[model samples]
Target chain A: MMTTETVNVQDEKKSAFLGSISSAFQGAETYATLRKSAWDTLSKFAIPGTKTEAWKYTRVGKVINHSWMKSHGNSQINLPEIAIGGLRYVFVDGLFRADLSDELTYPGLNIRRTGENAENNLLGTLSNHQGDWFEALNAAFFNDGLVIEVDKNAQIDRPVHLVFFTSEENTASFSRNVLSLQESSSLHVFTHYIGSEHSTFSSVVTEAFVGKNAALKIDKIQEGNETAFHHVDWTKQDRDSRFDITTVTLKSSWVRNDLNIRVAGENCHSSLTGAYLPSGKEHVDNHTMVDHMVPNCESDEKYKGIVRENATAVFNGKVFVRPDAQKTNAFQQNANIVLDDTATMFSKPELEIYADDVKCSHGSTTGQFDEEAVFYLRARGIGEVMARKLLVEAFLADVITTLSDERLQTYCTEKIQQLMHS
Target chain B: MLHIKDLHANIDGTEILKGLSLDIKPGEIHAIMGPNGSGKSTLASVLAGNEDYEITGGSVTFGDKDLLDLSTEDRAREGLFLAFQYPVEIPGVSNINFLRTAVNEIRQYKGEEPMSAGDFLKLVKERSALVELDGKLANRSVNEGFSGGEKKRNEVFQMAMLEPKLAILDETDSGLDIDALKIVAQGVNAMRSPERSFVVITHYQRLLDYIVPDFVHVLYKGKIVKSGSKELALELEARGYDWIKEEVSA
Candidate 1:
């Protein structure tokens, strides 16, 4: 009876905590009906515990137990220069900052703030909020975001750069974005997240649509400071379309990324690649899923990480092929290197194929540095530390080379080197 | 100059080199021929500071420094090179990049500036020609995907580039055809100078035909039992190692 009473009291406390967060944006004009329903779904479920199969290796107590205040826009902080030249957009505390951003006008592109486009129906269509705490939270309270639409048969020459800056203590922010590419269109996007040295939390959701014969590529870099970041990306590809994304996580206190891609049409191609380095008690988790709903589609995924100094990294990748998805080809691989004895890595690659005529493969590997390679390098007059560094760089070369932009590759490489020596 | 006095070493608590003694002067090539498991390669490993083998008792002096006290890389920076019988294949590390790093590191140890890019490339071109190494092979990963002959030639090419004071070739002529043997010998001969010395360790005397040695020594049961002029190698070749074993036991 005592245990039962304690469980009930804990449930009450969790409900009260979630209720307080939801009441902040009562009766908001952006997706009011959808937000109302999402909050209802969120209130029905408690925070996931360690027993949850999807989150067995990751602990979320640090994120859910805090009393976080909503972040207000702060436009006073200095912004760093953009690394690559492109049409740039800046978001501060989940609010778009036009003063710090480039001109939004460009050829063959339509860009708008969520508040400006009240008739847009693509915001809440792709991402599902049912039975998902983070998704529900993001959908119910996202204040403002960007909506991008590429014209039909248009080829955009310049890439789009989006920067999100958070500079507050004990605050939380939510943002949602949507990208729509018409038939035979092509575009590239780069996203960067920067945080100040204060305890903060942020959640971002992106819904993308790839039309027939369209091509879309995205590269993301996350640089965090005592921050808990949650990102969800839902992308749908049409017939003869191509979708590629590469995510590189440099630093963060805690991070959880969910990438879901659905092949809704035939002859579509999807490629996903990522590299992460976590040290100093940091925690990073990446969960990816690719669903094949039609015939004649291909999907490939590769993620690599280096864990050091008591850090933890978790990778779970799944590929699903439906009964009608005949002639589907899927491949997934996860590789990691644990640099310290105290470091931890959990990797699971799973495939669930219901189609009779499909080819699918998955692999996971976790290991330490090759001692023979180290000795060989040291034999050639290279120091012990430099030898290990060279080997680490070589191990990550393949993953980084998958990026389509050379400048982004160089930037990521330089950032990794800096973090390694730091 | 190199000197080894009463050297004793062990691997996994089993003795390999027992009370071995030798003296080598500059401008001299000494060939040490021995039967299988006769501790020829053990000497090379110990001199190169391989921690796998523990030196139980030994004193080695190389150019006025206690060679055994230094680390492996320090020994290399101090002008000692070893052309391993089986060169390591290090994928993803370009040959030119690795050599440049090595050259810069050695220069830094001697309080010198790094070599300019143009000068470094020129040096690479000039030295790689000594062994007739293909331009493509010179730019590829170190010893990766190379044939047996290419691997040996790469070792000699590295020896030429580093310009070490003393180089030990451990069974470098073992798996080479006649054509490859002549090319490897030519590369080594071109690097011979009064300021440099070579310790050529081989199981056969066929290599001695191209790169002539000043002296030949017979090592058996971890000890040098016979020392003579170059004719000793020929004698041992004509009459297999059985005669040397009998002579040592008698």
Candidate 2:
């Protein structure tokens, strides 16, 4: 529907935006080839418009129209106290703060700064930049991030906490992290994102590799004030490996999460679970895909949302079974509750199976609170508001209970209660 | 303890209870027997402040409070309970958690502190045993996947926990078997006190045999056309409601 003149104008705008940011990393020497390749891809593609099929529900005009400067080194703001006990790594304004972080001296675990380490072959291998704009943006401009590697047969007793705190206004921050687990190693990670008081944009990419017989679980929590947050996760699982990821989004003005998993080996298992609660004109979008490449693999995907006030939520999940992926089991479900009449929810569950012996199913449901259930609680002397809160808590219990960490579960439950009270 | 004067209610623009009147004093168990479509369930629902039924003209006073002006939860907080014919099934909400919330909220309404966890658990054990409810069912979701008998017994169990001043059982014996009916009746009988009153609404005299009522009233159409002692229930059961309908028509 666009004329040639409009296309030319859009191309000019895209070129100007890309040129402004690309100049900042002009003489950087770390990962020079990866950075140059990502920049080339970014220059070729403009920000996806509404006409784009994958981004049809989410509009990125706010991100493209406004000019954003790179965040500076540090801020004068105080660091919030950590609620869950673990080895904490803190990053402020997209730069690692060694003074505020714990010493990198855990047994059988190696932690390196991506900017300082130039020998990580797995750093830019898993993520696909050619098809994703944000992935390319993160790879091209990431200043500093963590590289975590677990030795073979090592089992981590304590969780690893990665905190990304932003305190700058009208700025953009990028972090690219790579996590690799050797054969038979097991690790649990908790990633927390805290935003600034003023409007900002943050793009984070994490690429995880689960070796044979390895187990990796990551619980991500995103809670911020007036921010645009984008997170991209790419994971590859080998034979006899397990991968699990759960993302809980409590607060944000605008957010988008893309999760992609590749089941490359047989006898592999993958799980993707998410719970998002958006209130007060907030917008949240979650897109996920799981590819079954071999036989005898299983994948389970469930995402729930509670949209309040005039907020909007979008969920799209896709499962693909290749021709050789016989005896594959894939299940996907998306459920949403729209609290107010003005709230909106868009849910699409898709399954593409190419093998004849595969078992696949997908379903999506969207509705309001059960009025009969509400009345049943109210008739027991509980107030209407409390009744509704109890129902919401019960609805999200299944997703929250899947978290192995008891403290994290309690923290999430309390956060939900506080948000409901607000 | 409870009074209703010339009560009129309508559901979906159709009148269900017209010019119905009833009165109950402290410690009295009154049985109201009626044929099908005689507004027995409608009266129970209207008294419990159900929003579906519009009170076109009515006056209901419970313990010096304007019952009609209170909301559904407020009615419960003011010591009024309705044992539904078909109990609602709420998945994922445990029965213990629900009862604890109800107990604390009711206590708060009375300006009392919340019950301690130890005492609350003890009370749950004691009250659940009163209805012969399985201990496992007490910890499960509220009435979810319960059988016909278990659901009815759960209704009685909840009533025992709330300890309302005026309890209205709306066809509690509809789907209950003989054993379940007796267990439910026994549970109700155990909770009877000098300050608590009951209004038992039923179709047959079977439930009255277990939980004897002091007075019996026959409802025809929308009003009580005949009022008598326990003998009236037996007479109506022995014969049918044809005499009452013919008497009302004449």
Q: What i-RMS does each candidate reach, in Å?
A: 1.2, 0.9
TM-score of candidate 1 on Cα atoms, chains taken together: 0.93
TM-score versus the correct structure, for each prediction? 0.93, 0.95
Q: What tier of docking accuracy does candidate 1 attain? A: medium
Worst 10 residues of 1 chain B by lDDT: B85-94
What's model 2's TM-score? 0.95
Can you list each candidate's DockQ? 0.60, 0.71
Q: Distance (Å) between predicted and true CA of A363, model 2?
A: 2.5
The regions of model 1 sitting more than 4 angstroms off are: A1-13, A25-27, A356-359, B235-239
lDDT of 1 by residue, A267-384 (tens): 9999999999999989999999899999999999999999999999999998999999999999999999999999999999978899999999988999988777776667667777
Stretches of candidate 2 above 4 Å error? A1-10, A24-27
Tens digit of per-residue lDDT, candidate 2, span A251-339: 98889999999999899999999999999979999999999999999999989989999999999898999999999999998989998
Clashes by residue pair, model 1: none
Model 2 docking tier (incorrect/acceptable/medium/high): medium
